[model samples]
Target: MKIKQLKVRNFRLLDNMVLNIEEDITLIVGKNNTGKTSMFEAINIFVKTQEISFEDFSQSTYFIFNRLLRLINQVDFNSISERRKEIVEKVIQNQMPKVQLFIEVEYDVTNDSLINLSEFITDLDENRNDATILISYESNNSLSLLFSFLNREKQEISLIRWLKDNIKAFYQTKCFAVDKDSDFKKDIDLSFKSKIEKIVSFEDIKASRTLDDTKSDKNKTLATGFSHYYRERDQTKEDIKKLEETLTNVSIVLKGEYEKVLKDVISDLNNFGVSTPITIPQIEIDSEFNSESVIKNNIKYYYKHESINLPESYNGLGYSNLIFMVLELTSFIERFKNSSEEKKSEFLTILIEEPEAHMHPQMQQVFIKQITKKINKAREEGINIQLIITTHSSHIIAEAGIDLDKGFDRIRYFNKIDGRLEISDFNNFRHKESDKETFRFLKQYLNLHKCDIFFADKVIMVEGVTEKMLLPIMINNVANSLNNEYISILEVGGAYTQKFKELLHFIKVKTLIITDIDSVDGNGEECKTDFANAETCNSTLKDWIPKKNTIDELINCNEEEKFDTEFIRVAFQIAEHSNTYVGRSLEESIINKNLIFFKSEYTKDAINKKVKSLFTLINQHSSENLLIKTPWDLRPKSSSSKTNFSFDLMTFDEKETGLNWEVPLYIKEGLEWLAGICMVNISEK
Candidate 1:
């Protein structure tokens, strides 16, 4: 049996969120305040405490309460007509706010223990194997009392304040079994508490782990953990007898030492009037050894380094955290296995929050890799252990490979869209077999270079080494605000940028794809932008964005056509200098925009001689009578390296050379739009 999904309603920011669980491991990732922690808290509340506080209610729930209060305040029960009063009462009852957790479980009836799951299965169909258990925290027979209180306090106190103060008293937690096939619900009795525990065992290792280095702290090392484990673990009769016998001998020797140490105290006590003639008070010490107490207080865990032994705290936090998680996981699994057959849970879910805490990137990667192996081993032992990890670490995400059967299907992206939590299941991101090669390339690319896009606020997909090296500078010059935002700039060339279209759309991050026009002539031969019958061969421009063929149409395409979706826009080489000239690529586009800068003395000395001569020739001619139609064709073959040209530009400092250049017009416009959109999004939030 496994938890297929969890639906949380009216719980903090997770107003109506559904998390689809993977069979083994589910990785939840997102930016801050997107309800990753709140989701965990809701589950923790339901599984452990069942104590729902007023603060736990979502803002939407408060709105419901406010509307209900106004309805009650406006009505007059004494003077209202029966029909009107009935309508108002029904609305109030229906609109009462509640926080609910729905746990959907899937099982194979042939293999699973129906004796354990029978109470929660309401479905009558033999073919169906899914069931839902709804644990709801809602008002219990307190509607009338709540209405009366609201009416009495309507003038004196705020409704929100009143609700906050008295909500727990009126509300209670209830569990119901729901049929998967028919959506029918059956109320489980009070024994539902025990039944829920037997179905799933939930544990969490929160981000704020206690890793105190102080010797006085009880939970300072794995030795302390062992004490708790020893208490819970069953011991053999022979082992118990041996421990008791050794402890008894030690206690006897300790008693003799204690008597000698307290000799003066014994004499003083005897001198006092505390002793009677009939029964003289004995001044002897009695010492006893308790195994649990001795284990808990006396054992200390140490790390041996070379010839020296150090305490566990002596290790770095990264190592300490890794060790701590291993110990906790082992303990959880052992405890589950140690439980009696009747009480043991069918599945164990371990939710670890930010396991990358205090760890370096490589260590984080190794920890995830090793932990996954450990979880797989536990599953091999016939224990259904589902590991859910919430992380902000790209290293861990990258190390968790994106194979469909592995990490890719298990990743759940949590995004906050328009004041609501949205979950995107990567498992649902399907691809055609024809696109299998593209998917493989994308997987490798992300693993090697761009996994950070998962956590970025915005993405900029640029065309090759030149754009990758120069985009940061261009962004700083034009869209300075982007420097402060989490922006991931990926170098996926024009030919392949279209491959990321589906993924970018799925993530829904505001993205700007800066690519080239890659103009070609009728025979599919590379051509200048202004060549007759010139068309773009770039896949992104022709097939994905703008969807234009001719250079004239692409260059004249309106800004609105550039937007593929609300979150994605494309930009390419366009007309510059009042539509006089058009560049076919980024290198030509740069020279066209900064002709005078390239013609300057400093640029001539800084650039390759052959490139400088070509730029000088282009600058000397008029736009209409230029000998070379584009800088792309005029450049010497020896100076054809775009990377070297970019490097030359990097050497020219505006502060030192007193010369400045601008980013191409198309890129500037796209970046400004991206910045504007990000600002609008921030303001809306």
Candidate 2:
């Protein structure tokens, strides 16, 4: 059965969530602590209720959920004032921690007329529901986009069409699968126990009843002829030792004799100007060796074997996990109603949590490739493969390339910023995000494509869209005066400057930063000045730097609400401070006046019209798509603090233009002084 939709309410961290899930592979990812795990828990909780309780596996259900899953955010103590809010909301709104899931499984109707046309609303148990309705979105006005193969007609299509064409999905989780090994123990009951007990007896009875049981036939033959062989067999182990001694004797004689013959053969081949053959069938063993024996007389020519080392503790608790993915997959396998190619198309929803972990990078790729091959095999043999997995591995991410621009039908992105989840249909998305860094890297390094500087080489780092929209025009006029290359200046939803670390390695350049110091992390003072420095600072890699301040230091604003709102967080602080560093005037001009915006005059003629302008002064250049994502703390509509920022203002040009910055100024006097030192490297090649 295919899952059509999912609805979750006040279940742990998920607070009234609903998603329209497709039946095929669905991928989910987000930044840390942004409810990705909570969403999976909501799904597991619903599916898990139909199975056995946690006490059968762990000590208690709550213990597994709290200690194992760690679903609930632990508290030193929760006062009534805090906990009472939930109780009050229930009385007023009648809300409950209702974990609802909708799975629309499609099976062929042998008789279509038998379908209950009288509204299938009664399918769910109404007594348990707080409320129910189809979770449809208002923004899905592009009816043709949502459904497949429509001829401009918004009419409802057949179930056969939607099932065959439009089903999209994926299943993956992380962090919570640590205890998956024992999950199935809860589901094993009396019937499960009884089945196992009968298995041995049933196998023995079948073996005894069969006339052509193979072992019986072999036993009858052995009964008549085998006794005659035992006298030789009893003495053969000693024979093996004797043979080794003889083979050693023969080897010493052969080494002395064959040296002359082998030299003669090589001399003949070389004199004839001919290459020698690879295999020599007739080799001189020794005059002491017997050739006409049943086995090779020379024991040296036989087996030279060594034992392979294997891991001990085969059933140890490594692959055995808290989530029990393989065990859950067992249910999906058993749910197969038929083996027919068409009938068993939808059998299981496979959820994976970083299957790449504990595996080598090469092994991770191989494991995924092999499993996907298995999935494809299952699909052909009448089982639908629905995969949900998450990963920080770029090797894993490239498996599902963002071919959105190439008109591929499948793509989506889930980003976790602070405590919020931002999901978008990547197939329909158009934006410059940090993932583009990784995309640019892979395209060049992995795909071996030439870099397009508009997409790569040019590192654009600003705090928000405010700077993103404004800088290009300003750079066009001012950059050359200062010798800063007027590259594409864009914002990667940030103040997290460190995200650019890996990207710097790929493209071979450090990014220029532009940001406001945050309120907490950017706060100043030396050695024991900050709270993190009190204990955690000495324990971290960042200990060399005395203080890690909140970026609230850079902004010039005085308003406290600046921290709570977007667009204003950086610029608002700058405006209210009345201080002159990146002042309130420019801040108010961009934020309040809406003086900044990019209304895409986005034709290539418009983009490349300015694109060539960047090349007009360049000489040598190369670029790579590095898939390392520059993660950030500052996100749109988030109240979380912004930690850092970067401004990727310049880049190297290919020397074909005579604008290569790495060249010495003596030969290229036409180049301005500002064009010096922009290249990240100067190789001796």
Per-model tally of clashing residue pairs: 0, 55
Cα misplacement distance, residue 269 of candidate 1 (Å): 6.2
lDDT of 1 by residue, 1-685 (tens): 8999999999999899999998887889877789999989998998786588899999988778877767777777899899987787777776798899999999987778877778888867788888898998888754574665657646687777877887777788989998655758889887776888899999889999877666554466566566656665565658877997999999999999998999898988767675455545766678999887888677667889999998766777777787778777777887887888988998899999999988999999889888889889988988888888898888888877365446367789888877978898987777524477777877788887778787787889988888888888899889999988888888887888888987887878889999989889999998888899898889898898889999999988877788876788888988775557888878888878876666555433455333333344433434343444545653323334666677767766687556788898988888998898333222110
Task: Estimate, for each residue in 444-479, the C-alpha lDDT of model 2 and write its tens digit.
Answer: 443222112112213344556545544443344334
Judged by TM-score, which candidate is best? 1
- TM values, all candidates: 0.86, 0.33
Q: What residue runs in model 2 are displaced by over 4 Å at the alpha carbon?
A: 20-23, 50-97, 104-309, 312-346, 401-418, 430-685
Cα RMSD of predicted structure 2? 27.4
User: Each candidate: what lDDT?
Assistant: 0.80, 0.32
**Model 1 poorest 10 in a row by lDDT:** 676-685
Model 1 error, position 189 (Å): 3.9
